[model samples]
Target: MTNSNHQWKKTALSVVLTASLLGTASMPSAMAASAAPEAAVTTDALKAASVGQASGTIAGTPLLQSYALTDKLQVEIKSLLNETTSEGTRIAAVVRVRSSDANVAKIPDLELRVKTADGYEYPMQASVFNAHAIRPGTTEELNFLVKVDRRSPSELTELVWYAVDWYSYPKKETVQLAVPVKGQEWTGPLSSFANSASSVLPWERSFTLSPALESPLVYTPVSVNRDNTPQGPVTTVKMRVENPSATKEAVPDFTIDGRSNGNGSTDKTVFPGKRVEASPLVLEPKEQRYIHFAIPTDKDTVLTNFNVLTPETFRQLDPKGQPSQVSYNVGRYQVALPVTSRTAEFNAAKPYEPGQPFVFDSLSDTIDPHLSVSMVEFHRHENEGEGYQTVIAKLLLTNNSDLPVPVPTFQTKLITAQGMTYSGNRQTGAIAEIMPQTSYAVSYAFNMPTENEDEQYVLKFTDAKTAAPASTTIGAYRVAMQETKLDVANMSFYPFKVKLNDWTLNARYNVPSALSPNTPISYTYRMKLDMDIARNEHVVVDPNSSKMQLELVDKTGRILSTKSLPFSGVNRLISGPQFIQFDTLRTEEHEYPLDINIYEVITTPTGEAKRLVGVLKQ
Candidate 1:
């Protein structure tokens, strides 16, 4: 990498030396070639996409420059453009600046100010990088990321300028720029402008909402003024209302908000799967109506870029703010989230039986963050002893932010026991950061002992984002050994006496336990081998390991391993509409009560661990 940097330096130097190689006029072309196609413009206003701005303070130089074109515009259009935005349009065009008198020793204090055709200019994010040059061609890619809220272009009216302080470059030195541009627009329709290529639309603009509202509700099944109540998980939007009109007595004042992004600009921001409300809009004589209503968003949606055609329908609107505030009595208006009217469900397993399913959202679907959750696979093992059940899940993390957003792999409580919880392996906690809309996947594993015991699990994503009323969801699996063969169970010993009842066993060519039924026997107590078959067809009689074991000896204590046969019903796996089998396992040997030691192990992503399954012997 170091060597590559050296090569790049050499190339840059050679280009500088070539002087005429890359012409000054080619800069714009180069930038265009690197970026995607520019957004379509309908207004004479500048494109409002999140683009980086040039940084640093322009000292003494006027930020706005004007020139009287010898060629007058057939129809002049003045727009007061602002780079502010609504939610979801967070991609910023960062702009940085350094003075021409950059001294390696001193760092300058840089401040940025944006000018509007309204003669208003505001400061942006801090442009802090410092260099020696005070007037060096200051450059920055401004990340003034914001979605457009309104459409009426803030066209470059008369002059555009900014004031900057050359902090360290020269203590109190400052600069500005004032460029002149003859923006033209058509007085009539595009057809008229089409005939006159010299004329453009009086306005061309777009906007989005902040923090982006997802799956917003516009109204109930039936309601007026989009009086939809907010339900389920959602973000909040604060709108500022202003009635910039003279006569507050605008009889029957009406205004509405619209989502300029979807449905070709006619759709309201309030749609299914979202919530909406009407602001108290009234024009008393000359009073302005700045009604604040919160509208939920579906994904990152474009906001109110619609114009207030008339006070009967609209007096003002701003769709780029949170909730993408809109002002219009515009009939058939849309200002709620335009999400899928139908709900989406993710059932972990199917047949859609009685069991639970991991719910993303209710009637209204939940907007999911970029999370890559892999399917959870389950397994059951048995042979030597009662088996173990295991469940595994994983996800990867991606940086999905214009800026770094801290992401933590949190532990959602999974039902461990009746009331026990594994909190998680705190020491080995997972952690990472997701940058501007990135994606990531991480894995967590869990396991437990299962001898037909029903178990449940859970996983929750409680980070800065991905919050909900439940604040969690079901990430569970019931422990059961499927496709099981033999399941033996033992009945209690004869409780009436120390030893009684008819208990017997036949040996092929050896001794047995208790010769009580034998005239002359080699051993006393007999060992009976009883097996409970689960899958009737899966149970087979052969020398295969599928059989049970038994042993017996005389008082001298001679260890003996004996063969045993199946005894009992062919316990079928009992296939049902949904597999729900509950059975037990046990050995059928009474040969002096041999000590049986069983060790159960379950698997998890981290690894396997010993699971205490309780002792069965004295």
Candidate 2:
């Protein structure tokens, strides 16, 4: 025989013998015992032949084929993806390891590398596996990332995996697998792959509560939407989480695989998923709330199947009154993607009109102070020299419950149909207390651009005191300005019953303007009011409130000057003759008929105008 042929035959014989010994080691106890002596002899002969023969590389295994690192541990590469990032080219391999032993399997220190066709091997940059132990009959998924420097060859040819012995340094079992790179290239920015556009299928998952509780917590997906920002694309997932248990239940921590880079690198390669809105740590008993998660991603990513991990841990007192920690594996929920409908119903916001009531059943379990927004008034005014417009919202709140309820503060916002937002500038009104079955009015002044007067506006309210769920929108009302005109014979306002007995107007010359001395001698117009006033017992009127205001207007309904009726206190509205002085007028003003406006001004203890109640135009 030729020397080359002899060497090839000997190498083939050694490989066959080595394979037999490895197979014997994995057999059942009875079969392994029967072949123990023969396997030992074969192992010795194979080792002797391997010493003299040239070291040959192992053949590459196909992707997804299971390979044995030891008799108890099995591993496979489920998927591979390559992405281009600003820092470098990233090759991510999704690896899964399974243990079939009766005892716990100690995972060996693992090393992974990406081998290119040009003989370049890039070492693993990071891994998701942080532990070294795996329970019997359990499986764990790991993400292995290999980073190639910028401009390096990215044509992946093989995946080189090594299992190194923890005790014996530098000794490792290596395996090479052929990579199918045709469709594995991400071909875009790393953010695009991580933030791929995906939707949750219609799904409802239930988790058991504490042992003391009877009902389970229900979780359902409501909607998914993508928004583009200057930083990147944010994909938000809205979920409806409900706790039907009689006892308060803690909110479980939720995590999604692939939502984070998990590269364990210092570089800010990717951002982690975050809860979109502020959430309460615990769900009140029988409380249902909607939560949102904002994840960063791209438009091209498709999420076929993903796992949501929810593990809940809490401390509970034992029967003996000793505290013990209890952990419940809420479980990893596998969600299928690309669904059309949601399983849970998303509550639609009910539109309200001015003066319509938006009733709130309960603010909390113990504080069921049924409150309602009985009336809403929109008043628009232009600042003469400030170059802006002021929109005032007069809200009348009534307490329907028997107990006195303190008025709730709200984070008020005025939104337009064109997506413009104006924050409330100042709030005024009696906010101390609302008597049982009584009504109190408050005003929120929003200063906006003059050009926005024509836009459709909605007043939105969010609770400012309690840390309510973000989805809890107290109310939204359409702001439509209406002019209230009353008959001159019968003049009566809300929260008060009064009669306009008689009135007289007299004009007098007042001091001239300092800046325009030759302009004209201004006429000081005074009107005396005489009437019988009867107060509404169900109204919460502040003691230090101011009197009704009077405005002299032009023919076009533009207010020319304003003055307040002289009154001692709110309780004595009809004490004696009250005069309203409009001191800004010219001699030419007496020729044209002047229109008068009456406004009820509610005030706080410090004399700040709380609200401009009702308007009566004559």
Candidate 3:
């Protein structure tokens, strides 16, 4: 796998390099961070990066800093699923610690935790690390290391985890490993919700192979919707037979039911293994055809999740129609696609380079499943170095339109340090057919004069994928400027009423990259806190770049987080960490309501001011 390391996944948003792994199998293998040493801190204040630089943890979360995985100490954590029916924590993790830190001559006590998606914390214990003394800066290699977590068959998102800091020094930097966990979903008791249930066609003998026609089956209704409608759904399911021309085959029956909580419906069928007998449909000679059924979608989002149902007699249980006491205790389920919201975090989207493909996770969007970008171009990169003149251009052309929406196109006009707009297609441009919601980008390289630190350009586009096209200007920068100091006092996330505890976060405005001016730029960051825990009970700040602050306001006029700025704006191009951080602090025992204003000396003519939160320990 190209970028399969656990560290890469956790730190991608902050790290300068983009993850190159395009395929799934070639991704991170980190289960979670290793356990903390007997006396390490497990709070959310560790260093963000260690070796080449990495992300510490998500903002607002309990995790603090980097894990100092020294040369000799070996520690690894893995979330495992419990393998049996016995009631115990089925999903767990294992830890192996050994002496690599020369400071510890013997194995030290270890503390471990398996943090779940909902932010639940579970701690575990395991072996210790055993090693000897080490020379200064010596890399003592430890031997064996592994985590033994039981595997379960039910899990949605992977088990996301990070461990507290380990006090062990000399051996720094903890390793992370992510193990692929797959399991069945949690289906609760159905006795209360199930309206009616039954299993159809449990067994049949197959007689033919290729000619598939119709097979008799049955479906039992399970629950009722809020309107008291039959919750169980009816749908046709196509199947692929392994042995189409078999002399004899066992075909099982299936059923459709609702989810345990009666939210959505589910389908499950009993399987009698290879013992059931069934006959394949025999079609007219040389006449193979497909059949369709009217599966209603009134209460079901997916029409293909029906499961096979079986009777107790198939298991040699009492032939009586009475349900078996223990054999059929579990709820039945089938494969169905559930409806979910379409989302892509705007904070992660706004600042983008034209040439680089947009990172929209469209899996949930109802985009035309077949629409695709034919050409995405950026005529020239907005910012070029000091000496020569450069250009950035692009062309977006596609033929699919199941999903339609107006697309934004950029036009460039070059301006000099003296603030002069010369003749050029620099400001804004337009195109047709690039229908609504069907947006993409393109880019081109440009060379600029050697003395110029940056070039400026404005972009025009319809703000939302709305029908009416609106004109708006977006800035692009070719930053290679002289030293500048940046300061701000108040910061806030409005409309949503940012709690003092949640608004102190900072964002890296520009991450230094090879694509930027090949020169080191000096920058200073400062801030003032309007934090008055004893007095100011409400945390609020100005959201717009007006007489008091900077940046655009949300629809509700509240300012979005600093992380939402367009760090990649061509006219306002920054080459730092892509995102910029003012000062952000976290005091463990403070309930300071967030309310502060932040200002930036971004440029002489143009700049920004914001409101955010800050908390420093006394």
Candidate 4:
């Protein structure tokens, strides 16, 4: 095998560790060596210190500017310095890295120290490196701070920058570079959260918690009244539990018990003001959930630390040979977070507002920092038939976290001015994957009351993942009309055409008598489509782009209701012959005149959008 290939294999351990640590690897020996220096030396005296340089490229990567560590890794010293302080002399170094291969790289652990001729080593006090994953062929920087005795510089014979590569191969630990004093702060995006709780599980299970364990119960200050009742002051702690165990073991719950002191007192207090989480509390094997609790306290009284509990139930054979139920706690777990502070902040936000986009203003997943939702482009549309209308909305979902989670769907409702409510239809998009840092547009269609035009309505979005209650309001909007009389029902609309042969008038079978203001309510519509548009080409419809509008009226042409339906439910890919169903409307009078307008969108060869307007009168 080639030497390069061998080196790559040898370095695999370091590489995996770097990735796991998110580029913030640490070295115990290096950290322990950073202690008080024994001697001191002036700046001029350190100027004569010995400087070492790499003889040649080490690991395929060239020693372009400074130290060479391995075949694929090299460090370029940016600056170094030594300054005298009241307690001792401080040494600092600024360095960056260069890698030869295309693999992602990170400098999780880098340490620097000065070794005097007298066998004393002054280790770096703090080292901050850009721990972010670096694309191969790119460089990452790190800053180091060290303190030593002023006299140590005079006897300093070597300054070393320690490094280990991705493969866990210990590279050259000592290399010489010019030292100049400078300070740097580590400023990089925080690493994504990863829970390793499964490793410490008492029994085999699929999930873990972000904070593997809780802190030992601690004391916090609280207030008490003259009657000894706990008053103001409260402490809170947050925790996340993740399920990554086998599928069968995925159902789990987290709980904290509030047992009373049983002191035979009239006040049967069970950790007064202790709040418990509500749950069936089962999670998918790979799901992570969060919870928090607050305890009221007073400086004069100490609240008891509640016992954390997680129960699992099973159906099994009993000693009597009959199937029986059994429940048990996972372990004697304690709360991991502390309520050391006297009080916690609780910020309350409004839940609903009209005339604005509907936003569920809470994180969907307790453990994930990404995946949120917003609803926009809310409007009203009138159907072509009498007494029917629908509200159309666009859902703009976004993901800013590194985890590529499935997009979530929200339950929605439309509240009319008369206090009546209606439900929306499910118009799913063709989205399969929600990549990080990307957004998807989802469409929603809500059936509305016919008398709601020119009157305000409330649109609300509810996320099943969150308990926060919030809603968005949409104001009264004017329903506009666009019409064009077609010469024939068989006319073509760029990508599609309407078929006049399938036209028919049918009774509104689903309308209840109470909802029908007149007798013989009926619906008029046609099977609208032309199959010859694309025999081989595929029709791709974006959920956010296409729409269907409808308006219903009485015999005298009095407008009843208006509604709109976005083409969000259209098949993502269409080929061969496809049929289109026009809006279905319900009216009390069967002989009312109908005005139908079909708006179809087609993309031209150059990507220009063309709208096909077809109007039908019966």
Considering every candidate listed, which one attains the maximal lDDT? 2
* lDDT by residue (tens digit), candidate 1, 229-328: 2442233322222233444422222233333345433444442221132333344442322222233444445443222211111112236533222221
221-339 per-residue lDDT for model 4 (tens digits): 11111111134444343344455454523323445433333443345333423223565455565555544445444433443334344333334445887756433332222222223
Which should have the higher lDDT, number 2 or number 3? 2
Judging by TM-score against the true structure, name the best candidate.
2
Ten contiguous residues with the weakest lDDT in model 2: 54-63
Positional deviation of 33 in candidate 1, in angstroms?
22
lDDT of each: 0.28, 0.52, 0.28, 0.41
> Against the correct fold, how does model 1 do in TM-score?
0.23
Model 3 — TM-score against the truth? 0.17
Q: Report the CA-based lDDT of candidate 1 relative to the real structure.
A: 0.28
Candidate 1 residues lying further than 4 Å off, grouped into runs, are 1-98, 102-154, 158-177, 180-232, 235-618
Model 4 misplaced stretches (Cα beyond 4 Å): 1-363, 366-372, 382-389, 398-405, 413-425, 434-439, 448-460, 465-545, 548-618
Return whichever of 1 and 4 wins on TM-score.
4
Q: Give every collision pair in model 2.
A: 195-297, 195-298, 429-610
Better of 1 and 2 by TM-score: 2
TM-score of the candidate numbered 4?
Answer: 0.27
RMSD of 3: 34.3
